[model samples]
Target: AKYRINAFHELSERASQTYTTKQMTMEGVGEASRLGSKIINCKDVSYFWEGGCLLKEFSYNFQRFDKVEIVGRNGVGKSTFLDLLTGVLQPSSGVIERGESLVIGYYRQEGMDFTGDDTVLDIVGDTRLLGRFLFPHDMLNTRVSRLSGGEKRRLYLLTILMKNPNLLILDEPTNDLDIVTLNILEEYLKEYGGSLIIVSHDRHFLDRVVDHLLVFCGEGIVKDFIGSFSEYRSYMRDYESAKKKDSIASIKPQSSAKPEKKAEDKPRKLSFNQKRELESIESRLPELEEKKAAIEKDMNSGALPYDKLKEAAELFKQVSNEIDELETRWLELQN
Candidate 1:
């Protein structure tokens, strides 16, 4: 624990140095561009909760008209980092500094702050630019709760765009959005001139929108690479390869390093309800697989009747959906 604390402190120091260097670099670059002169700066930022570390020693700088993508697996502190950037969550340590003229527009993943009574049109109307772009002309009267998931996402984006902020921070912007809406968002962001820091798992969307990548690995490590998603993937592959080779070369003739002791000795136990659900899922999986195979066989066979084929296709779809839902539930129980 003490060594971990010291490592974190060292990382914080390094982040602070990086932050200072970025600040000086931006100042030297001069600001009189068409996209506005403001720069968004994040200094040695660290956040933790209930003795669990979320973000550790993170720092990045965004200049006018730059688009940066934040990438990492789930629970890697991407959302937490965004919250800190937008002043929603205070960092456990370090500081964040923004330019005096900077304005920030943020879109969160939860969609919680929106009121149900407000129609989609009314919400969009409040963000005049978004209303124009999304529901142009008298369409602002639609109720928010009545809109589809994709429509709600568009409305949310429009609201943030209305602020005309020099910097935008989007957290998991593509999750649950339909493909059509995702394309529209890509088009809009391509033309957007302001700085952007977007967190997303959609690799295609990231490739379309961002020129740089920032990754928080959930350790005390943060990685920054300039280029697209494809480039990031290549870098990661090479890095992993090098790490593997080094690990192999360092192997001792005697034995490998002992595995570290886990904090909890006992394995987590599932409740009766959870065990029942898991068993139910396990029971249905074989049936679902069998049904899926039968449907595929029917569809492939030339002698199958048209009505039978259609029925098989529909049944297959339903079975697949149910299987997906059941698997998600099972995973939740295990976790």
Candidate 2:
């Protein structure tokens, strides 16, 4: 009799849980259906600053069905594109057309600021939504000021969803988020019936979230590819490989006499400046890289005091820029 009662109770609990899940699922569907998007249209858009070109003559229609992932190698100004999209920085030329009833929710790399004393419940005013985002009941009464950086980032995401914006812009959204949180966030984004734009280096995240790409192919050119991130990468790789193969196939066998002439034409000594640069570049690059890594480690380690963090960050950026310049010079020297 006792065993039968226990089994019945377990089954009853599961049925109750299932009923609650059904309710939530229904609510989610209803919420998604109510959502919409704004048509943010860009025409002949270009951005240039400090006598350097970033993007030139780019065009796109950002709408509900479009999930655009901005991709570029570092220093190509993906952030500038984001600024253009969000109206933070006006384009150097061209027109940006926004929808009449557009609402934007932008999640930048920086964490959200929460001032004064406030509980988690006070912030969102709903625990079930928080639970959906991996916040448990124990975390409800926690003070806003006491939350960790990741927690704050997660909360900011939840807040964004709760407000139900018609357009969302995320820049490096996965930087500090845990995998579990990222999974849940991706799930939420899947059901989101709104326009979305993201700038991310996370391949997995890009593969899952975005359907189209705005690629910065260097030299102020942006290629709008109608495919996922993986597809674009595959296409580029295949193109490069075929190009290399064609070059190799085009090379005819050089005569022994031609080889001797080529050897004679080769310079016996590099210029004084070139020699000095070649000698020091190999050592200088490693030092700059080491300094960069050490600064990153200290920043991540939380060892630097709050006031010094900004200084460290600036120094790190300077060192990184130096490394990039030096590496480019080194490659030229090698060539």
Candidate 3:
């Protein structure tokens, strides 16, 4: 516990330094005199991988200055769809058209590789830009291998911005970034003139930056919603709750209509242990949901310590997974 406290203090100090450091800016340069209103068009696009459909007949027009986020569970083809849009992968069917003047910049989750011996100056030739990124002249000789995770991510982000792309695609860009850097990025994006598409699990980041969302529901389905991430989440909660109530109401009516089946014809009932487990799950579900809500509130509050924020993010994932599992089992038992 003492070591943890010390580590937190060190992280806090680093964050303070990062905050006082000079800020970074991004600008997009297009080849044409002016960019088209529709920067990209996805015409009935479908992508299949490993014998399974990732996206099916997806059609959307991406316009200049459009800030869109793609969100879904893990392994739900969010990244794959981005790849299709960026031309890294061909669509299984249909087409993706890009504007002639569009210059796209992509930031992948697996960041650009750096040789251990490469110095910060070697990666970024401009000392002024290095200073803007918190790498002063004294630290120019610092090797990439020795830089902290946050530092390396900052460097990689600088590289992406240097390209001056009209369309920016970022995949999980918030991971391993310091809060100060994240703030700067959010501020820059708020003023950024380009078309932005982001794939990130950072709910707070999504709520702050994007105007609309392309929700990747499972099974090759995506829903477009014109609202912030928090609003979408709240809407889904209400929708699911209403649907569950309807299901329960319908089930009760069915039970009243159905005659009692013969002993041999009735389906086997849940064992005693299963029934107890189901009851236990039902009792715990509300408590878990409340805990999850609290965690989410803290995440969006922007007041949590940097170290605690990382812990909360991980815990949030675990709690969400547990809830999903329990809900699935509860539905099975009800059936």
Q: Highest lDDT, which number?
A: 3
The per-model lDDT (C-alpha) reads 0.63, 0.68, 0.71
Model 3, 1-335: lDDT tens per residue? Answer: 01122211221133112111011222343221246655788767888888888888877777666778886777779999988988989998997888888888899978578888999888888776667657888989999999998899888887777676778899988777755577678877776667789987665667788866787766676766666766665564454456546444444334445455333233345689987897798688778778877987898799999899989978876776677667555544543
How does each model score on TM-score?
Answer: 0.61, 0.64, 0.66
- TM-score-wise, the better of 1 and 2 is 2
lDDT of 3: 0.71
Tell me the deviation in Å of residue 239 in model 2: 0.6
Question: What RMSD does each model have against the real structure?
Answer: 10.5, 16.6, 13.4
Off by over 4 Å in 2: 1-38, 248-335
For model 3, state the Cα shift of residue 267 in Å.
Answer: 22
Worst lDDT run of 10 residues, candidate 1, spans: 1-10
Write candidate 1's Cα lDDT for 1-335 as tens digits.
11122212333343333322222234213212234444656677778888878877566555665677876656667787778887888889877887777778888877545687997656655644554346655556767777777677777777777676667788877765644456567877776656778976555457777876675555645766567765655554454455546555655576455444221322345678876776787687668767766765666676768787667766755765675566445434533
**Candidate 2 lDDT tens digits, 1-335:** 01122211221133112111112243333123233343677777888989988978776656554577887777788888888888999999988888877777888876476764988888887678899988899989899899888898888777777777667788888766755577688887777766678887555556787777776766677755556765764564454455546545545586654766555544344588997886697667668767766876777686779788878867765775676566445434432
Q: What is the TM-score (0 to 1) of candidate 3?
A: 0.66
